[model samples]
Target: MAKLVDLTKKPYNLNADQIKWVEDTIAGMTDEEKVGQLFVNLFFPGSDEYSGNEFTNQEIVEKFHIGGARYKGQDSVQVQGLLNELQSASKIPLLVAANCDSGGDGATNDGTYIASGAQAEASGDTSVAYNAGYVSGREATALGVNTNFDPCVDILMNWRNTIVNTRAYGTNADSVIKYTNAYLEGLTQSEIIQCIKHWPGDGTEERDQHLVLGVNELSVDEWEDSFGRVYRNHIENGVEMIMAGHIALPEYQKALNPSLKDEDIMPATLAPELIQDLLKTKLDFNGMVITDAAHMLGMTSAMRREDYVPLSIAAGCDMFLFFNDIEEDTMFMMNGYKNGVITEERMTDALRRILGLKAKLNLHLKQAEGTLLKDKSELEVIGCEEHLEMGADAANKGITL
Candidate 1:
């Protein structure tokens, strides 16, 4: 009768009410089941059919019992079917999420209309960013996708950052702040939660963390200018979750360990001093603070030096995200937990954080004794006339060129 819930102790960290909820939920899990909540993987179900034979994903889903899956480029009906399958297989309701940050197109392509963040800037309408996020939220809801990870709040001070160039609203701090806040506002308005990201800001360094764990050499003041402005505003405006970037800041070096030089902590993902000390503690983000993607170069040490996840979670990441090739890394985390490197308390912490968000967003389905999501036609919510008009007007406002 020993269950995963038994592995987790009577949670005392949360309020009395929350602790009660955690206890009730934890009681249903086995040790392996509890460990699974530590992550959300973004698996591309190859060619999008993802049905009949879920192909290779079956192993990851069946063996791993993952907490959630953040899918990419999955068309509408296919997404519904896959989600239905996932929910049925899991003992607990799986926490399903998607990118959908710019527009819901981040997931459903044709199902959601697209908006160029650059175009929104050229349009000079801040509301455009808001509307874009709103449209993303509405479209995602139609397909049963809830958590929207977008409206990247990076200042994007470097025009050459290819990954961020168009995705970001613009180059100016004031404009980025104005538009990002509006974008978050719109996403929030639609009853969907927004995760404003690349926290501590992804703007200072020119390199993409996706390819390299880029370091920001700016002084504390300069670093603040590049990233702080917009993030401060994001927090003030109530963006619920903020993602930590892989980029490093030389200025916060001493905080990482009053002794080690900048070379020792090139990537923030693995450094608790930088992310936990500087970000979570100093910034006081009481909400969820998640990692960018564990599989990215930012979190991965060189193939020879690869040892970051244990330290990353200990650093204060509430959740770790993985895009693809998930098994290897997920195994590492699970093994770490099994070995005591990652405590059950830590795994439970992530579960509580992720589940807490699901609850907050009202993503858990309602009034459904039976309605095959596939049998439904909710995909029509995206790009409908009302959304398109709102998007067009907002795009016009935020776009500059």
Candidate 2:
């Protein structure tokens, strides 16, 4: 049996009432609702081009009972209005997220484009990175985003790596840690939860996971000193979430089980040794673990969707990212649960952590107070002059001769 998590402990820190809300909410859910809680679907408010299958936001919440939705719109007003609609439609408060890595512009066209990881590092000031995160939080919250996927912590050891070269803070662990801490500190001040990314680390391989599988070929001791050190610091610093990339960490997998063959190795999203053992147990990360994105070739090519869909959650990921086909993927998760592929213990564990995240955000409190979203007046900061000037200042400082 999996050991039960102490909701009252660190990370979650749910009070008695909040704990009750988490437990009672899960207890009241149907099997379908429970299954739905495992996914974070994509949304493009402005166009049908990215709408997954033309399912409206209300339909998604009603039909899927999804735990979260990531906004992919490019307009500020559209994104905010759509997000408010999504939150109002759901029975449970949705964990709305935006890719705020560069800045608020990651979510909307009118948002601030503060600085890229490379630019922030080049500025020679951690405060530049801090402002980037703070401005991202301010604009994102103004647009109804409660979660941010930013501060790509993957150490850029391989310069040829396409995915994280410019996105990463620096080439070494110490530099990456310094800027990531500053960024998260600024984001934390805004009360929007932070999700650091690409676990087991990326940027060690030249290939992009979106196009093909990428491996972090570091030896156990080498990994422990570099990428492992980076992750340890973030986990200890109280990051609310971590995004498990499709990249493989073969060395650590082999160290844990000597007899395991090369073919047995899988991405962090489907490997129990990595997710359950290494991340959850060895690293002692009590917060939620969400997959990078399910549609990437690195994840899809490894196996058929039917097999890997359930294996992801069973492997210990708390939430799956994006839907390839809404109806089919929803059924796949439902069938996986019904067939006992995802055991009751595992299901409950995932649910508790998912709800624990919402409870930590005090979504329940905000919902009851009818203040889950800020007023339209708050949208003034989306691309205001002040934030634009901050972005310009950071850019000028980051300029190199």
Candidate 3:
């Protein structure tokens, strides 16, 4: 067993064996290296072009020791290049991930528009959901995406809820659980870590957390009755990570102690009671716990809103999925440590969780899988049937309701 490494306090201490591994094997990471573990950013495949503006490229990841990436396209080659660059560039090897919600198609166009597994279940023949998930995992694994932000476990409680519409299987918790497990089986069996998202259930909320803070109408017990099953079940089954969103459940919101209640129980990304207390303590999730995106207004950011990095840290988030707010989180957290708002202990705790998860991916001190470049012809399989068949299998075999 590897020696326990602690990051809760500064002047951190890992046993000598652990220290040698992190320092000697991990390119001698400093506090900066520890900080980089807190991020997972968006990717534009070929380079870094977002909204027609190119703010970052392969170089930024290399220079900053970025943790991982949330890829956004089907250009497998470009995705490969970016992943390879990000992983190879980091002072410590990186964890390359993406939001392959409906498979990589959600990430890129070269992918098939296989109906989300959730939609497949509603239409019957769970095979559709299964195949879609399976195919997507295969496609990504072949292309080099190590982790997938998928199998949206948000229980579909409100049919009128515009956001989750087709994203969820149905309002039935059992249905969601079955299909979710199948989706995970296909993806994890492929060796890609799957991140079931929008914790505490975003299905009951009518608003989209991306645009504004969303709220769940169910009380804590009601939520546990309806949707919390998905979250707990998945964690129990050993999912590697979970992404909390900007939605608030009144029960959770009302329970918050001072300093936090002022934020409206806000996004799960910024709430400690939700992230730490609910997720870790209550739900017993021991894997990686990441935020949706710091730049999202529904959530908090270091630039526009007050800096939320410290609060997110103190509350118990292991990583920040960044679409455009890395520098600020890095700079602000650095300041938090120096200024004393976020103690060294909190910093180390966050870093340990981050490092521990990435390490689970075998991404630090040890290189994980998906390093080989695909043959040019493998590109043809990007949106092909064998892959589609896999998704169909997932949908058919996985969905029971």
Candidate 4:
């Protein structure tokens, strides 16, 4: 096993009180609760009357005790109210997250729409990337969202990669590193937990992980020169979390353990050799490792639903993203722990990391004070003139053609 980082240190930065809180909180949790902390379910935008999804959302919170939620495009006030309700419903404070890949607009329709990574790079000013992150963080934080799954650091080397075309920074590692770090800097300054993503890199493969498993065919040396270098830089710089992609790297898998058969190769989301051996052990990424959405074909096609949840935790993933059936998945995890498929030690480790992230964001502290969003004035900053100008300025300077 890779030596786990001292949880109370730098990146996590838990004080003695916070440490005790996390420990006590974990100790108080039931197996079901602990398993619930390992998921970040999708939050549809609307109230009970309007969307009818609110009841299910409440059930996910009250029953499953979900750790976090991801929201995309909703009325700012309604979204905030929904999040507050969800947070209030949970015993532990929820770590609200969003697909703020491009900017805050990725999460909400009212948010500033900044230039995409490719567009940002075209301006030839890394500061635009920083501005993008800042705007994303500022707006997301204003709306009570603490996590942004963004700064897509993938090197778009494949011309045929449709999904990553404008999403990625650029084709080269140097540019990706520069822009990614700048973007992270902006997010960090705004106090939004940034998740650098699509680990082992994407865009080298033409296939999308949502439909089928993709492969980044780089050999060990090539990966180290490109994607490896970028990821290590972020990890060393104390990135809070990483989203492991559904893609696979056969070369790295073969290099790590040559005995593996062709059928054994699996998406990084379910591959212990990839997630545990490669990312945690070899890469020494002690921070949280969240899987890409389990509902995707890349994951579902590779492994059965019941097997993926427990196996993902056992394979060193701290959280599973999305859900096909929230209640069913939650039950599967609870049973996994009871059946000894997911060990207590493993469950504890996952909970510790999950709570540590919550602690890092001081969600526990916020929950205690009942001050998730201080005042509506914070919401006023969303899509304000200054932010829109920043987005427009970035586009004016960054867009190539």
Candidate 5:
């Protein structure tokens, strides 16, 4: 069995006020509200006007009390307006997140479009990578996106890894670490909570996790030297969160549990040994561990629909990303907790970590101050002359050919 980390100790070391806020906030939450905190629902900025979905964003916010939201493909102004509306409607402040990997352009149409990792590496200028993160972080923060799912630190060891080629820093560990660290530095400077993704790495597999379960076939020692090294370095540097991929580490699984059948070995996202033991204990990662989209075939295909919430919670995941039906999923989690499949202790632990992250981001203070993205000047920075010039400069310098 994977040893669990002490959940009481504050990883981010919240001060007394923040600690009190987290405790009080969690205490005030009902079971449904607590379960909702574990989910990061998909938020389409312009979807409110479409009339296709029965529940509007505000309705969902009121219904679920969702902790955060993941956004994609909206203009800067639209994103800002929608986020402000959602945040205002929520009982607790929402942690707005986006896949702002390439820059804010990755999530929004009007934001600065920067070069990919391949292009940045081709420039032979690591500064371009840093600038890419900075521009992305800056624009994301200005637009009320507090969390960014970016700086994909996966080492592309497989030549046939199509999904992560441009997304990842490089094929080599050293280059990936250097560029990733530099990029994280820039991103963190803007105070946007950055999440280093596809933990235990992702590029070794020829298959994409989006379609099927991806496996990293490296031995324990090989992983220690490559993916492990990059993740360890970042964890030590105080990364806010780590997104565990659907990829399986067979060697680690077999070594940890020799009695288990081959069919019983699961992906890192649903394996306690991988998450609670390997990641939490061995890696000494004190930050939150979120799963990749639960709606993906990589996750859903491996387990029954009802097992998703309970199994993932047992696997020590702090948050679940992108369920097919937010309302149904939220109800499933609530029912799981009530039925004792997901223990209250586990739920509280997850809530503490989630709330701790929110406290670290000072969401409580921001909520009280009513200062979240209220500044017109900060909003003006989105796709401004200076940012656009920076993006163009990065593109010019980052031409691969």
Candidate 6:
């Protein structure tokens, strides 16, 4: 049997009862439930139809028992209503997440559109970053979302990097670190889980991962001083989650193992050296590692879905980001487990981290209390005057002379 992770550890910090609950819950989960925990499906707000996929969010939960979901931004009332239904449908509490990098409006329709990353970088003030996280966390959580994917830490080194240019703070490591730390502080105060994204760094390449396979071409020492510096600081500061991107850091991979051919170098999401050795072992991140969306060509082009789907989980990513097709992907995952692509040990480790995150969020307690969704009164904070004013001030300060 795989060794059980100590739930009372730093990131999780679950008490004895909470630990027991997490263990007991894991022990009781069926095989389907276990596999489902490895996926975080994407859903749209307006309709049951999305991207030609007809399955409703409820169907995903009922059929696959998915552990988490990411939803598009909508008005507070509509967002909350749909989330409540998904929460009620699942046996386990779902980790509802939103892309709050721009601000709370990234999650909720009426939320404050605080400074963009470029704006925040231009302002050159860490407090702007802090409020971006604080205000985003406040509005997002008030609408029942538990995870915030913000403070895109990619260094804007290549000016041609359009995808992450406006989403990043700046080109300096010290500046990125300072702003990221401040953002973490602000998000923590609002009591929401923070997940830093595009791991092993981005912006070194001008290509978008969505359209092509992106690579971070820095040498080992160069990366260590730059992107490595940023990640090391965040990991040390107790960031609870990371989103592994499809970008590759081949130099580091080769340094870890000289045998790895150039063709064998995969994106961080599908690379054991990057995810397991570099991120988990070297960096010592105990938090959950999720893939950046699964459907992106950055990932899909690497290999067939059947191979990469399970390979993502096997590579140490605890959760796959989105589904190509619910049934087909689930079948691929199950087949991987059955065919031995995803070993039992790897599966257990992924489950432990996934459940550990949920437990850390106190989902178990809220599930029992039937209080997953806050009342509509909390919606008042969505675009409150105070937040709007702060956002406007931040925006003006970010304008370059």
lDDT of 6: 0.85
Better of 2 and 6 by lDDT: 2
Clashes per prediction?
Answer: 20, 0, 32, 1, 0, 0
Give the per-residue Cα lDDT of candidate 1 at 179.
76
Candidate number of the best lDDT: 2
Candidate 1: lDDT of 136? 83
lDDT of 5 by residue, 49-140 (tens): 22245788898888878888877686877888888888888888887888877777875788887778877777788887888898889888
Q: What is the RMSD, in Å, between candidate 1 and the native fold over all Cα?
A: 5.2
Query: Residue 401's C-alpha lDDT in candidate 5?
Result: 56
In candidate 1, residue 146 scores what lDDT? 59
When sorted by lDDT, best at the front, the candidate numbers are 2, 6, 4, 5, 3, 1
Q: Give the number of colliding residue pairs in candidate 5.
A: 0
lDDT (Cα atoms) of all candidates against the true structure = 0.64, 0.88, 0.66, 0.82, 0.82, 0.85
Give the deviation of candidate 6 from the true structure as CA RMSD: 1.7
lDDT, residue 80, candidate 3:
66
Instruction: Sort by TM-score, best first.
Output: 2, 6, 4, 5, 1, 3
Error of 4 at 149 (Å): 0.6
RMSD to truth, every model:
5.2, 1.3, 5.1, 1.9, 2.0, 1.7
Q: How does candidate 3 fare on TM-score?
A: 0.84
2 or 3, greater by lDDT: 2
**Per-residue lDDT over 170-256 for candidate 2, one digit per residue giving the tens place of the 0 to 100 score:** 999999999989888878778788899998899888988898877899999999999988999998888889999998999999998
lDDT of 2 at 338: 90
Can you give the TM-score per candidate against the true fold?
0.84, 0.97, 0.84, 0.96, 0.95, 0.97
Estimate, for each residue in 186-223, the C-alpha lDDT of model 4 and write its tens digit: 87878777788898789897998889987899999999
Candidate 1 shows a clash count of 20
